[model samples]
Target chain A: MPVETIDRSATDMKAEAAQVSADIDAFFDGLLTPVQDGRERLFAAMRHAALGGGKRLRPLLTVAASRLFAIDRDRALRVGGAIEAIHVYSLIHDDLPCMDDAELRRGKPTVHTVFGEADAVLAGDSLHALAFEILADPATHEDPWVRSDLVLELARAAGTSGMAGGQMMDLAAEGQALDLPAITRLQQLKTGALIEYAVEAACIMAKLPADARTPYRGYARNVGLAFQIADDLIDHNGDTAAAGKPTGRDAEAGKATFVSLLGEDRARQQAQMLIEQAIEHLADHGDEADLLRGIAQYAVARNH
Target chain B: MPVETIDRSATDMKAEAAQVSADIDAFFDGLLTPVQDGRERLFAAMRHAALGGGKRLRPLLTVAASRLFAIDRDRALRVGGAIEAIHVYSLIHDDLPCMDDAELRRGKPTVHTVFGEADAVLAGDSLHALAFEILADPATHEDPWVRSDLVLELARAAGTSGMAGGQMMDLAAEGQALDLPAITRLQQLKTGALIEYAVEAACIMAKLPADARTPYRGYARNVGLAFQIADDLIDHNGDTAAAGKPTGRDAEAGKATFVSLLGEDRARQQAQMLIEQAIEHLADHGDEADLLRGIAQYAVARNH
Candidate 1:
């Protein structure tokens, strides 16, 4: 498809999705307002970390999935924002001096560079706790089991076996050569877990049909893989302006990556295949899955 | 009180609180069992940090407060374990190279020293999330609003304005000449917030009457301050063997502390006063507050 056509398609999807996006933003901005006590500064840091920049894709997925079950927008917004909070916290901690040591993220200075490493670490920790708190809020659940399960799901995702475990794997794998399966496993756990959580959480919160959950899991798995592959491509081939980060740094760091192992063309093909698989998995859901399908396509198609 | 009498009282309280301690160990042992997926290691780290430890005071506090309003023993155990998880996480993170840089905690190599800083940091983050997850579990909550509110309170305490903020102050105030109020405020937030959460969470879970809540809060606030002061005193007067870790390190580091500011005798007086206040605040709750009062007394009396 032509670049213009794809851009227009994305715009239309986002345009129709305005209510969900707006609610996500509002929920984030509202919950993050500083209290009168010294606690305000923490919320200020949270708002600073969460409110602006980045794609907000995870939250969007949440809102979209929640809407499919005819759940109210407000409730979805809280869940969506909660996911973003986890994502943002991971990014902040990942950027710290002891971790990725990135100076910038999403075209802005990383949290540590601005707040100092200690504050950044604590801020990330606080955000992680806040996400669970948001998900477990009485307002977010009509049923105690639903609330409890959501909290547990998110905890598992963000905890060691999910995001943190994946991160630990990345730390071990960095600057080391790895075979295809190993690399795939690492990326699947690292980047794929949270993305999968976003989709799974929405389905669970909306209590979607039992049959739909398995296929949606498959759809999410593909989207998650495609998302990481695209990231690999962007790291290799995209410009700083487009990618909003320094490209080619991954190669400089001697990190084993999809493109490095598979070659650019094959990597691109595999990503597209994953996107196709994701769309096919969603075929039974029809119009309710349209935006998700479009997003899957965009995940692989975008240069950034 | 005589040292012999203090030891006898400590022995009595520990015996009375033995079930809470055993229950805490059991819950953790069950929670940390390896799952089919590879998430076992993370919980392993959590179990390592949480299962074997000092007094298990935080969990005991939760149990005592829960008993105030007749929350079932099983529910109290879960909530108590949750509080211990949060406490353990804070301790693990605080011992990291970037934070307190301690080589020992709870008579073992600190989490960062043992697990590596990356895993240590992630473990702390995971435990924070898990704490909320466990508390928010429907199995632990007979009251949905109480559960949600407990999650919110713990989040605030552990997050930026409470524990994190107090930690930031500690990091900034290391060598500074802080006054009594400044020190008190810092300790209240840093050490007191979570203890306050433990008390309030138990009471909330128990569905205590509104009037009953205030005393618990008061009780927690006083004991919280007393704990910090006692900690400072331990660092001042106790030996490594007696204390289970290095002592006098605080003064050597020139860290602003209650003992440094007020002298040993005055600091002891302050701790005693706080403990008395903590006990007095339990007046309305009758014998249900016995364990709590004993725990408060132990706070001031324990060498380690």
Candidate 2:
């Protein structure tokens, strides 16, 4: 349960995670060319927001999950890129003046700060729409039911009841006490929902049996919670340079967090326990889930 | 072309439009119940925003355009509801304090004003996502190619380079005399893009031939322009009671418009011409295009 025993040096896993993240970037960069001349400017903004830096966790989760179904890299990458686009769009909108109002994200001025809020907002809206557009593309030739379910899953994940609703709760809970239950609910909705979507959609896209999907969903939900709690711990304990943004933001904002409510020691313990539970859900899938299991463990143990 | 001679009484047409609008509402109302109890509240927000009210122009455009292919009322109505959801989402976001800052939409308080800005923003975001979710539903069993293309069209119409892009231009161009071309581009991007999407999406959903989509797109673009110009004119000359909102908002905001740039008489003349051109594009399609033709004409002629 000790942090030192489980914590992996950021440098140890940084190379591979960074590679996966780059693969995601490259995948999206290839799709961004305008099919028509008039589309030039819009495509440029799409690239600008998309190519911006991040951990690429959601997309990575997607690719890893797809791999479990024995889908090849190319197909996984396309769907992964699409999920990342949605993730990027969410970040852009979250940074808007009316939302989180952060001036920085991914070690640079956020999209709104660079592009102006209206463009940032529109970029987010457009990119979110484009996610479904890409998923439903005829080139993918995914089954109609699969495509429909993907759209439905994503809409629910990103919608008012999903990430945004979680955001509302976070905002309302700011400067207030959030107990373990409230914290679980908040993180589950906000971050866990999308992560669950990424994993489950990958399973759905690969046409995995319903049995495979059910457990994968559980695995994903647990990993998502662990990932968020780790974020809270890091935000409290991480160095600003290593963390890529200011640390202790939650503390400064007086936001309710597992760390704040449960103490850093207990929070880290809970994260590990959740990660273990997550990996256990994938046991029936065997080594096909190794990357997913690796990432789940990494979620809690990574330094930044 | 005489303004006085045009039968300006849109009540009967409005009543008919309202019935179609009601059908669109009923479709979504019956369809959006969440499977999970926790999700139903958010789903209710989605339904509330979609069903609450609007001019229903976008849905009307969808139904009218699809009728051009054939009166496949079921598909047309579903697509119509989907398009209306997108339009409503845009309005909800556009009216936010960070955006247009309007107090009233469709004669009632804006969504953000009633729901709180955060919920309103999420509601809009969800609505945008849900638009695709609805369009891509398995129950609809729409062709994958058609659904994909429709998704793309909708994305492009809503994205940064389309409606969102135009909004940014308007924000930046406040108090400036955007040249005639600039004015056209702004309106086209801000309003025309989605209007085009509505019309084109309907045609695509109907499985119309590719070549046929071109004229419909043209018709949509033209009516989109006329609609904005007429909106400007109404903001100048229409009655507040008839319009169901305040008159003269554009002028008060120092926003550029066709009516503001040219004289009122010229704006009216231009709107008439655009509607005529919109109608002309439907020439080969004949009486099946009547609803579309009538709506375009009504767009310019309506007091509201």
Candidate 3:
């Protein structure tokens, strides 16, 4: 990889990170209002699952990428918020007792642990619907074409061949030996699809045509791989306190991951290489790509 | 109510319903092909859950209503297919052990029973995503506005205050005492919302203005109510075999339903009255609405 890294101080990164949580948190807080009717519990569970906690990594990536096109601030937050909603809903479902059966998330009780299985399921489902709702609404983008593409792309990303399909693959792979290619395909479907959506959303919002999107697509592809490797590394050897739930879930489940296949040193090097290449994909852009470049670094650094 | 019934022979209703099942079944068959990969289980589960059975009432209603405007047959089937997908996915979730805890649907084993809980849940999520994907595809409609509207309305109808929200209410209402008004509200959200969407999709495709939709809206509202009453009546006195799944679940769960609150005689009367009124809303239309009229009667008469 070429040495094309852009230098930014820690303060710059910190400032860029500040509003993502606040903005997305506020977006969900407003969207999921409380009710006095029988459905109040559902909304409350949705609020609890969607509003608080987590790194907000997917939305943050979207927001950082949006700066590349100088997209409208409100539109950026809404797009980013919808992406975050999809990510959070996936987490809630993945943590169900019938699924991962975990009790902790973001260092706190999982939605199923706190709200019970029925509410957890409904809450995840409600968030799933709401993500498309936000994207389809005219407020997300004045152009219905953009809104339609966002809905189509997000649905594709999260559907059978996308994140949801990847989840099915992950479950079926339990207690089985998966080679590197199979593991890569699984991770690409599960986590990588949504992450790629986060970056591609900016390109769509920017009105870039299909042919013009190769560079951004390449950028998103690299970022997704790097981000997945970082996650495997975190689950491999990171501190429980920093990692939230636990370390070594992949090993505990006997599931093969990038770290399990490649080892930690190689995984770290692979993630770095992907990040540099991801940054290189944006070589034509000027400093508008700073936050995006910074994000490629942060996705690996925070987890590596 | 003034008599406005369209006298369609039983053979006509049967023939219309025949193609609907075949069409939508083929749609899912094509959408969810078998896979040799790890994700095969997930797609198989989704296929099991989505294809092969049920009343196909929602999709049938969309088809019957589409006749009112002579909507492009292919467009109507796709829209109807998407709505059916949403309905089936909802049923899969509702039948989970944590929710309704049923063992049979369309006289076949539930998805969870056959595929395990994780696969079942993921299948439901995949179908839910597929519904939006189908709607957002340009092939669904040449106009992005039409596609966007369909996506928006479907998402709204399925989201927090739509069909999913109603599911939450139904779960919360178990063993509780709900009055007539409260029960009506619950039924409206739980089942009525999607039924309305099934009818409204036609008007949307026709590009009817908001004010011009009053009659159609009135027709859908009545049909939705009549449909819920019929469902309650089925659960109240329906034979197990004809109903596919066992009947009397509401009574067994001690859930308040229209039949429980209104008595079978009154509930039956109310459904007939609503169906008649629903038919009356179509008085201005010619023979084009005959199939829709038949559906209104079928929704109420099937159980009553």
Output the number of the DockQ-best candidate. Answer: 3
TM-score of each: 0.89, 0.87, 0.97
- The whole-model C-alpha lDDT of candidate 1 against the native structure comes to 0.78
| Tens-digit lDDT track of model 3 for B139-248 | 99988888888999899899878888888888888878999998888877888889889888888888888788788888888999988888878878888787788898
Better of 1 and 3 by lDDT: 3
Clashes of each: 0, 0, 0
Top model number, TM-score: 3
Greater TM-score among 1 and 3 belongs to: 3
Q: Candidates 1 and 2: which is better by TM-score? A: 1
Backbone clash total for model 3 is: 0
True contacts kept of each: 0.50, 0.45, 0.87
Q: Mind giving the per-residue lDDT tens digits that candidate 2 earns over B247-287?
A: 88888888777998888998889888988898789778755
Q: Name the runs in model 3 displaced over 4 angstroms.
A: A1-10, B1-5
> Which CAPRI quality tier does the interface of model 3 achieve?
high
> With candidate 1 superimposed using the best TM-score fit, by how many Å does residue B15's alpha carbon deviate from the native?
1.7
Residue A228 of model 3 has an lDDT of 89
Cα error, residue B89 of model 3, in Å, equals 0.5
lDDT of 2: 0.75
